[model samples]
Target: MFDFDEMESQNLFLYLSLLVLSITFFFQNIKPRLGRFFQPSLETRAKAAILSRQEVAQFLDSPIVKEQEQEQEEGISPSSTFDFDPYMETKVELVNKALDEAIPVGEPLKIHEAMRYAVLAAGKRVRPILCLASCELVGGEENAAMPAACAVEMIHTMSLIKDDLPCMDNDDLRRGKPTTHKVYGEGVAILSGGALLSLAFEHMTTAEVSSEKMVWAVRELARSIGTRGLVAGQAKDISSEGLDLDEVGLEHLEFIHVHKTAVLLETAAVLGAIIGGGSNEEVERVRKFARCIGLLFQVVDDILDETKSSEELGKTAGKDQLVGKLTYPKLMGLEKSKEFVKRLTKDACEHLQGFSKEKVAPLVALTNFIANRNR
Candidate 1:
């Protein structure tokens, strides 16, 4: 006899899981129209990795990676080697140059200056770097991905501006410097944020890629910032305030983080892959990998908030606890949060298994950095 009920239940569970992941930018109600735009142009895309010194000669010279290579030659730590500086140097430099040009000082001097100040500020450059790295990993020219990469940074800077406002996180410091609102008045800070947000899309439209790919990238970015994306996530977070653990719940917290943080990362990676001309399957694989890392970012943040101090973390430590914000450490124990990060890292790398090993090396190192960074 057929067990129709049991089979149906299993299928339903799988369907809902897929729906949650694929639809909501980060699990809210999905904007299917934008999601469709990022679909790969081909079924398969062949990619190459920087397997030797010759292959990486054009990029920045990474002393640490070179040292590791020397060790390999001498057969030391044969099973252990990783370096991300080369990947970071070119990316950070390029993104900074693009950013410098993206928002120049002009008439309406205050607005432009405010935008330039925040956009050109120092930070980890994580989002744009991810975009460039993803494109390179897929064997695409870094130039083709530069515009979108810069755009990603602009969006990130805008988010920080808003987050630091008295209305939001009320943060005073960022990247070891005063927040935009602290340097510029609240009015200027708000305008600067709005300008950067608009600039992200404007800059993407000007990327040298084909009209089709540019459109695709633009729509994906739109999806990430729209109603069911970052905005929704922020609203949820603010609204969830003062709610009990039982009220906000783990699922709700995850939803908030996914929408707020993960969606942008997912968009950044997907945009890079698409610009790099990845096939449909390859683009999807990268998105899944990025998705895991994006969520992992928040989890590690929660863990750090509990375990590190203000100086070590470069910001207020235990702020989440002080504010009673929902976090992995608060919901799950500190040990459990650490365990969750490990599993997420493992899952992130597993998605890249189909990629060229050499190409995915930067991402691998990046994942470790995110998991273990002190600040």
Candidate 2:
């Protein structure tokens, strides 16, 4: 006899074992390969659009910025008066002027001003500039990227305004000036921040970019600011109070920072690259660079909070410690944290291989700026 029942059971057991083995193989090897294959591998991605260090140094050594820096050395802050030669200075003035003109007047204007105040109050406009520069690096027109840049700034500003609300950081000062709630009253401040949030979408929808690009930009912005990004990160930060986290716990803290800060930055870079007509690979490369730098930026910010003064920082100092927030410096010690920043910056820059030196300068400068900034 064939022993039909026994045979059937044996065959079924064999099939089940094979199925489990297949799944195990997929997870162990095939899955990771598929993930990397579908998305570009970090190693295979193109370099960023930026200038070489020598070229950048030469450019900085040029008469224009040199004269401005010399004036500062001579005890005159160039920004104190306003000089139009250096591209950075000129860009700042242009952004500030646009912000002023864009804000309206009236009952609603009170909130508008508070929103603008948070943005226009003066700090490095690194994010917006990165957006613009990335666009140019990929051969896109600077004008084409301006709206996206502006929208990013608005989104960032709105987040700051909300982050400082009483329910959040409860901060009273920003950039050495009264916070939106302090200056405009809490209700007006909240409204202003809300207005800015809406305005970001408004700017995106109406901007010169294509409908497809606009959609992506809007989606990225929303993702960065919504539950999965800044808000989620903030929630985690608040929940982490007074808990001495281990390495894994600290990683969660890093996750919060990356979501809170890096996602938008990475989005800005990706948007610029896409608008500039960069290859998909190129765009991915810059996105990775942005992610690395974004994390570096936050780590540097934490370190500066410990080392720099409120006067220099233009905001409350030591608030990270006050809030019992886990920071790289707090967890890793100052020197190790600095080393980490350098390594991160190096990793970011390394991803920019094959990119034009002209396009890469801002990226490199950005890394150094974040790593070395005192404020």
Candidate 3:
């Protein structure tokens, strides 16, 4: 039997849990609302909804933020700001080392080479860094998060390779060099991408956390790339290729961005929180925070594509416009897109209101990075 009553009961329970999480925030900031949504992962019983506008002027401009601002202006505790450069450099180095060690240039040389060539390519390593930061935010050891961090990067690299194949975006340059399919044959790129995807699951299984956490992280990474996550978003985007720009509205755009970009970031934070042994509440908080920034990341990319030159972006610029693909900038002009980015980052900042300011400095910095990065 399907047990419809039990399912309804579970859904009601989830809604109540979400209400509990938001009650305090709702009191201070009535502008933003939260909900409960099912996450398509074995590890996630449910994921919190994204925030609506939270009236940043009312919330972030509180007495506490004003006091901090005064302190910064007076040169008292100027270092209160997060040191994003050094933090990113350290996390990237550690993640690169782990990725290199995980894949060796050994037997079956061609395939291994293809995998390494793409996996070791230049990029921000943002997903892995976010994973490590999320772990440390919850007082977990970096080593405990390393395996999952590496897994996220592996999966991301695999997506890049797949996206660049002839049948897909058909791009020639990624990271300022030829894409995987451009250098290696299409057959090799496909096989190598699959190999990296498989390795992500295998490598995640080696996390130093408890077996339970490891299993949770593994399921998260898989779901992030499967039908309900990145693939789902990409499928929708492809289907929308021929639709008129006016026909694609905010709802569809949000859907594509949420599933395609936000899901990986969501899984990264959730996995980190899991390995760090965060309480269910803390994990859900970080997941909600990451979801906003993940969407911000794509919105910024859309803006950059319209505003910057190809040389500045290190790849094709205005490519989204060329393909008639739907983008935030296209759907809502540059000014509105910029406003949307601000709303999202402010909402992201709101999720960390209960965490230690010191512990969440990196996430705060990441929100700024997403808002301001030129490339």
Best by TM-score: 3
Please identify model 3 stretches exceeding 4 Å from their true place.
1-81
Task: For residues 1-375, write the lDDT of model 2, one tens digit per residue.
Answer: 699999999999999999999999999978854643365322122122121123433432344321221111121112233322376776667666665655555566676667767877986777877787788878888777777777788888888888889898888878789888998888988888888888877775656766655665666667777776777767877887666755334456666777777777877887788777677678777887888888888989989999988888988999989988888787767766766676577767777766766556666666666777888
lDDT of each: 0.75, 0.71, 0.78
lDDT of 3 by residue, 1-375 (tens): 899999999999999999987986786555321111233342232222422434434532334321221111121121365688898888889999999999989877888999999989878888898898899889999998998898898888888888888787778888777888878899999999999999888888888776656655666677788886889888888888767975866767877878888889878888898898898789888988888888889999999999998778877788778878899878877776777776677767877777766778887787787778999
By lDDT, is 2 or 3 better?
A: 3
RMSD of 1: 14.3
Measured over all alpha carbons after superposition, the RMSD of each candidate to the real structure, in angstroms, is 14.3, 11.9, 10.8
Candidate with the greatest lDDT versus the true structure: 3
Distance from true location, Cα of 240 in model 1, Å: 1.1
Per-residue alpha-carbon lDDT of candidate 1 for residues 54-95, written as tens digits (9 for 90 to 100): 322232132223112111112111124555776577668888
* Cα-based lDDT at residue 195, candidate 3: 94
Winner by lDDT between candidate 2 and candidate 1? 1
> TM-score for all predictions?
0.78, 0.76, 0.81
Once superposed on the true structure, which residue ranges of model 2 sit more than 4 Å away at CA? 1-85
TM-score of 3: 0.81
